[model samples]
Target chain A: MEDPLGKLMPSEVEFIAEDAPITITPNFQAGVFLFLKERVGPFKPQRPMEVPMWLAVSLRRRDKCVIHVPEWLSVDALTTKLEEEKMQQKQFVHMPAHFQEISSILFDVASQDVPNSEECRQLIQAIVDVRTAKIRQGGLDDMKDSLAIQLNNVTQMEITSIRQFACHAMDAFNRLSSV
Target chain B: MSYFDIDDILMQEERLPCVASIDVIKMGSLDPSSATPYLRKGSKVDLPLWLIKSYREKNGEDIFEVDPPKFLGPKYLDMLRADATVINLQSWCSHFFSFAITYLTLFQDGDLATTIQDSFGHRYLVILDISQNAVQDDTSEKTRNLDQLERQLFHAGLQDDRAQQQWRRRQAHRILPWAGAPRRDAFELGHLTKRPKLSFS
Candidate 1:
């Protein structure tokens, strides 16, 4: 009855969150040694260095760095991408599992640096709303013909919402099959 | 003659379904002639049907009584019906069904047995529908493949003997005296060991 899929999804999200890249411009002209077995640098003021999103956020929090928003995260690009995805109806954009969380963090901490931040946030929210509604409708449609359910592109958070029900259902099926 | 063997069914019927009649203070004192020890009050103890029948004939008292399995009652079934996502449903169902099936074999109460069967069947179908709904909304095959790979990696991590052994070795190294003091010993013998004299020239 152990759900391998349920357990793995969160770790995958964490891995993606840690690995996502972000750029930061240091305010101070001093080297900050990281305990992660590497040196960040004797930072030059206004020179941007690319690091993992987590390290960038930490540096930004400590007032040590100003984040440079990635080009893909700009309002126009994301809005266009969101629109395209909605129109295609067959494929989701290639996004990290923790995209929403990372975007929220960027929106919260580095709003001034990001171009058209409010518009970007609105587009992302609208896309999320559309996707969630579609997911619910798909679930209802699949229930009509029990044999045709095929799961794909489900976010980790979405899986977590229904994990308990899925696990119990699978366990019941296993018991019935064994008998 | 049915799907189950007749001799097996007959043997199951020969066993008595009885709860203890009274509190047995001393196990050795009561029923000294019998091989088995006396049971405490409220404990269910099955005896041979012939022994219970003959004892009832002599005493004219109903000493042995049927104690229906707990899951055979309405409470558990109602809970299962109300909440499919109830915690520990897997283990609970397995335990209840095993006991209920054994109880059904011993006592030929058709109505109770049929009820249990129907309850299990209904719950199973409900679970199936829930699972179907959970997986219906996926939008891409690539994410599904990634999910499969992630599951494989997670299981591999659980079963990786080399990683487990390396972790144990690292823990053992941490506990050793030399591992902790190696840097400290080198630091003490280094050039910085000498104290610098403070003087304004």
Candidate 2:
């Protein structure tokens, strides 16, 4: 039984697991009801309330609500963490697996509300480049011991690229060896 | 056998048939017996990477444009890694290797090829552990046996002496400088000699 959706990285798995709670402020004057397994709201106009991150992202995308940036994702906190990660060698800094994806989604859908969003994006990009360079330099040595390589702060797409490269290399070796 | 050895065996199961990409074209004069597929002039069709490479070599024309497989990209890899058990890993691996083997055969350098080969050898041990854990959680013996039978069929097809010789010849020709270098005319001298000049002082 192939687990088609199980190929997600740890952070993506976490994202699905957390179903993280977020706070949002709706702009409309009247309450709107969102029905899922159960009716969630009579979401009041201009009233701040807690909901899952997925719902918040969706609602924000629709321009119905303004989402609050989580404390860890704030510019000041991420900048400090980025500096710490830069100094470390093999050890990755603590961050959600889907941090990059979540931030990108948030920044794209709710940029106006996230403070210093531009600078945050730059820091995230720099941190990613530095970590990826380190991993590439370390090559298979670092990856050899770990069951699932800790790709903290990297996007799901980046992880996929790495896996694809590994797969290609494996195929090439098999072909060459058989000959 | 070690974990890496098993992974190598599993990975090898993914190779696609060499001629899997060929299709019939109604209007073209392409001989059915030829290795390359017939393509009508001014018509557009997505050709497999290997077929395109074969045509380019034979015709000495760079007419076909290659679109690298999407499965080799990040989106597909990410999905595979997070939930290794859910997707058809074998199918994806086969599609990827079909194009990849063709690409590497045509373009690989000695150092890069060695590095890629080494990486596969080293990383498979770890990947095998991960894959085993995922497999244990879901896959049954029936599916495993079916996968084994399919792999045997693929390996048998590849073991054909004629096909193996053909592939070897292509590879040897690709690497042999004399085979690819332009022919020099018989009148052309191999070495230049200094002509003696009579200098009257």
Candidate 3:
């Protein structure tokens, strides 16, 4: 299905060397949004904060690649596949199915990039507004409300998933700025 | 000289528990009832150092010393105007804020102050948590406050609202065709690890 927001930036996807070391420069806004999203997952109540543009960028880049995978899905297993894909980048081979599935998350995001488009721009603005409000007002209560669904069922693994997404969003934006 | 010796500074009797002054004040006879209006009901956390100094200079050391004017809240709620790290988990409000605020005060640097001011806009409360210490990772609460600290710092760094708007709102997105995208999907455990196939449905 087509993404309603059109917020993805598929063209911006980059293929770093499997041997390429990932580095991150400090970015407060992007970091915060990633943290927030990771903690609550999607479909949280609307927060009155502004969204960092960089995170929007990260979300977009994530939507571009379609990483297909078989049913055996786990972060560690995915990491292994990503590593294998990187190592095989020298031959420019297609990544494993799991990597493709993960890339689909990014691709879904990439499909929405319309930086020049008004709809996309407005959505970006809305994100920023939400982020700013939350950052200023404090998100503790908001977090509780948003994660209320999962809070009772929350596990360390879920928290780790949030952290990984946050890390991904952060890495994508930092990489975008340099290019 | 060993590089690890530098870490010993955090271990000194004076700094152990990393908040000697706050402890003295907490144990003293200050009236929680007399706290200022801004004080959150549960936010009895100590005012970070720079703020303490600012409070001391403004209200006089005697008054502040009588009772630490720390922000009130859980240790996880403690925040500052800069990025959080493992180091921040053990930080005292007086020491950390004093360090940053002092640098800003002395240097008369616009960036630092702007960052701090920006943080204030976010309702980022700086507090001292004795439960958290920088010297060791043995406690159940390990680098937990670091998350709060990093969020505050991100807002501080974006002090230039106009610039941020100009860049994020006007320029970059206007030029790029794919800047806006849908939100990312939450990570699934299965996505991160492998599972055996189920035989029947």
Candidate 4:
């Protein structure tokens, strides 16, 4: 009966990912602004400083700063990761727990700042496709007899996406086997 | 099961083949064909699972002998063993797994439970694959033959698959208007109070 709705909504996940750190260079001088949960920035002109993604997005919208795209979301880095994912077909490749949410949200808010943003989006989509296909195709073998499986390097986004189906399947399997 | 579980209530109504080993007194209404004042010895009748269990509980266990239903018998087991994936379990019984579970409780039958587990083990992945990939397609045809429990599992998988795809498409953030929400122009300040009568036509 618990988890009837089964995991957070994608928007809620994006909200959680907002707290993750990003680098931003402000165009205008502003003193430290204190938010409810965290304090951010004595922003100086032409100087790079660490800030949360939400703050960067807000600042970018106001023409106050430009976001510095993270290295992992770069096109070249993602291409390398995709190759590794394809090479190691049997195992999941490690990523940030909220990479999917972060990447998508960044693309939404800071596409101009991110170089080769479209190619990066496509590469990230391809990586997600490859991983999901692996799960759907071969990942079920280990679950045939056991309730638990080793989820090495699997991300929170991946886990949440499949949590509903996996939980229901395992519950049914458990009921049948127990009988 | 809780008092309000409809599935448990329905499963309890599944009739079992029961033979009265000894004369049963004042229970003749259960069998319309019996002419005796009380149920006579060696009378065969199909009784609901609840009645059979009640007899076993309220009275001694010797009054009735419950024969294993034909569906769980060797013949059906052989059919199931031959090819479980192709079997139309719904045609045999509505609540097949639940009924089997109840049967296992009343009579400790390891073989029955094993057969069930094996069939489910084979079919579960196929159902998962179908539900996961068949977005926008009519899956009722595919799920028509599944047992009740299996059908529920298929639906669960289907829902999750669709949810992930929807979130990926950025459609998860659209807030639908509530059913009874007030309209945007529902009550203007001017509309709430009496408007001054329009001067000059």
Top of the candidates by lDDT:
4
DockQ category of candidate 3: incorrect
Residues B1-201, model 1: lDDT tens digits: 244754324433444456667654444233435444565566666665445545666766555576554445577656555653333433343344444555555455766655555555554443333433333333233123212212222233222222223322322122223345445455477834643221111
B1-201 per-residue lDDT for model 4 (tens digits): 477788778878988888888888998877789887788888889988877777767865668888877788899989988888888888877778878877777777888888887887788878877887876668889888888877877787777777778888878666455579755455464443332221111
The top-ranked prediction according to DockQ is: 4
Model 1 residue A20 lDDT score: 70
Ranking 1 against 2 by DockQ, winner:
1
Q: CA lDDT of A47 in candidate 4? A: 98
Give per-residue CA lDDT, model 2, range B57-143, as digits (tens): 886645544443465445764564454444453555543333344456665546434443443444343333333233232434323
Off by over 4 Å in 2: A1-20, A29-39, A139-158, A170-179, B1-201
Ranking by TM-score: 4, 1, 2, 3
Give the least accurate 10-residue stretch of model 1 chain A, judged by summed lDDT. Answer: A140-149
How many residue pairs in model 4 have overlapping backbones?
0
The lowest-lDDT stretch of 10 consecutive residues in candidate 3 chain A is A15-24
DockQ of each: 0.04, 0.02, 0.03, 0.25
Q: Each candidate's TM vs. the true structure?
A: 0.45, 0.40, 0.20, 0.85
Question: How much does each candidate deviate at the interface, measured as C-alpha RMSD after superposition?
Answer: 16.5, 29.8, 20.2, 12.0
C-alpha DockQ for predicted model 4: 0.25
Global Cα lDDT for candidate 4: 0.78
Model 1: share of true interface contacts reproduced: 0.00
User: What would you estimate as the lDDT of candidate 2?
Assistant: 0.50
